[model samples]
Target: MEIEIATIGGFEEVGRQMTAVRAGEDVVVFDMGLNLSQVLIHDNVETEQMHSLDLIDMGAIPDDRVMSDLEGDVQAIVPTHGHLDHIGAISKLAHRYNAPVVATPYTIELVKQQVKGENKFSVDNDLVKMDAGGTMSIGPQCELEFVNVSHSVIDAINPVLHTPEGSVVYGLDKRIDHNPVIGDPIDMERFREIGREDNGVLCYIEDCTNAGHKGRTPSESVARTHLKDTLQSIEDYDGGIVATTFSSHIARVKSLVEFAEEIGRKPVLLGRSMEKYSGTAERLDFVEFPGDLGMYGHRKSVDRTFKRIMKEGKEKFLPVVTGHQGEPRAMLTRMARGETPFELDDGDKVIFSARVIPEPTNEGQRYQAERLLKMQGARIYDEIHVSGHLREEGHYQMLDALQPQHVIPGHQDLQGFAPYVDLAESQGYAVGRDLHVTRNGNMITLVE
Candidate 1:
């Protein structure tokens, strides 16, 4: 059998992730993602209301034009997680392929919510639910399994596609976390078993997002410690405390809520995305949200909640809002710009529980948000978080454990790919032979 894989997106850049694997006539596509930087850059333009093709042309969604020929051959559209960059484009693009979208339960529900919320586009494709550690048949000769992996977002998985040729592991944006707070730890034994199979893993399409950095990615528990230390230091402050982070980070949000409760403050989750993700976690029993915790889903409701908090006593409540990356429309950014009902006092703290993604648009928006908050005399505490992607040491651990026949460094540009190649080479994997480095729209074919 001859197996071929195409890097539709996320091979040369950080966003707009989609990859296609072809075993015989069956094709499976993974991660129809959005380029948030591009989306934010083009926000408010007429193109915002355009179709998927237009959005792809504008660089907001994946370039599925590369898979136009195999649209009918697609077996499933699988998303590895719930991150917008992983599942955001499904509403716009999944309808093109007449295949069921198979994903974790949280991801499926989140996609449903996104589709219902996106008035401009609708997906007619079937939505199938799968959980971590579940297996399903995508084709007569292709079996897919979701191996649980730890990441910033909940329900992230490392998908392994077993074909007649061999098993291919899609291991993007994952880190080995032994001490996760919300989910189970990384399944190293499963990966090791796959590596020891006779056919084993033919190609390991791995995440290299942070491969340029050294050392293992810190566990989420470390982040919890950091957050506790920072928030506890300000427990005695009479002013208000406002925090912002990725809404999909349920573990971090849980930690924030617990800390707020411990400090004798009511935790209020504000913003639509915040409600969407945290509410999902609640329904799925992943996290037991405090019953008294106030959550506002709409703009009007958020404004009302903020006003009530202001009227009651801002110091008595901890407000967690969206816009850690400082999207102009997000609640935190609106608060920073004085567009919201809340005020930032001279000593009020704004805790950023996320690291800046370092994309050009993110850097600009974060910089502007911080500047405005500074103008309002708000104290800022940023980078009080850990990355979801693996660092060099974690990558080394994964490579040694998986022991695939070939390795493909993904989710990085030429500069980002350099250190990834160095690490893989250090593992005795040769370039252009056992280890391959390619860009988007390129194909890597293996015959068995």
Candidate 2:
């Protein structure tokens, strides 16, 4: 049996996450994602209003070139989670290989809503929902299993692909959050079980997003404290209280809702992306916000909802909207630019429960939004947020737990993965042998 793996994208970069795994004639592709930086840099596409196909057409993201190269040999395409950086490209390219797109239920629903909003009909790829601990057969030569893990989002997992030669474990973009608000914690027992199996893991692809940080990622519970403290610090205001955060951050939203409840106000959701992602989470039983909360999933609906809320007295409701990165078309930016009917009143609170995404386009847009918010006499709260990725000590712990024959870093550049390389060296794993540093489009083979 011949085992071959290639980084279609997202090897030495932060986004456009795709990887092809093949053994004998059966092949499986993981995470056909879009590069947010590439899209913004090349075509000036904003994340909130991004259309996947447009990025593909402009050469801003990868097409189906990787799967197409395998001809009809591809058996399945899987996304480990629902984050845009992991599953954004599935709708644009999953049909090319005519393979099943397997994932947890929430991830599938989120992808479908994203595709539908783009006015694109669903593709032919079958979406099969697999439970966290269940296994599914991709073909005669490959079996796929989802091992539950914790991250910022619900239903996140590390996929273990059992092939003819050996197993390949994909551990990209995860954290070991023990006190997650939405779901259960990481199943370390199952992970150790896989690590100790006879065939074991021939290769392990791990996330290097926080390789530079020196410790385990702080829990979502810590972020909840920050958000709650920020909200409590604000003085009593009679006007609207608006917040902007990552649309997929259901935990943050839950915390905000709890704060709103404590402040004797109803929570209203604005912006299409925010409502869509939140709806998927709710449907999967991930969060349990109050039923009285109102949500607007369309631009026109959001505008009308804001007008009604203003007319009825804004203090009665706490609005959580989009534009965390200041995408111009999102609700917050439109409000800031006076394109929407809603106006920020004096003493009103506009909280940004996220960080600036450190990209040129995002920097410019965020700057514009802040200026406009100040001009409108709104009190702005910024950086009341925390990261979702693991840090250096966390990486060390994961490496120690799932001791594999080889490690390949994902979702980072060479400079970003340097700390991980050092950690591996200290653990007696040398470069080019047990530690594999590869770039995008490079293929590596595992031999027994």
lDDT of 1 by residue, 257-326 (tens): 9999888889999999999899988998889988888888899999999899999999899999999998
Candidate 2 ranges with C-alpha deviation above 4 Å: 41-59, 67-72, 117-122
- Return the TM-score for each candidate structure: 0.97, 0.92
Model 2 Cα lDDT, one tens digit per residue, 356-396: 86556788889988999889898888988777788888888
Q: What is the lDDT of residue 433 in candidate 1?
A: 92
At residue 131, candidate 2 shows an lDDT of 80
lDDT of 1 at 312: 97
The TM-score obtained by model 1 is 0.97
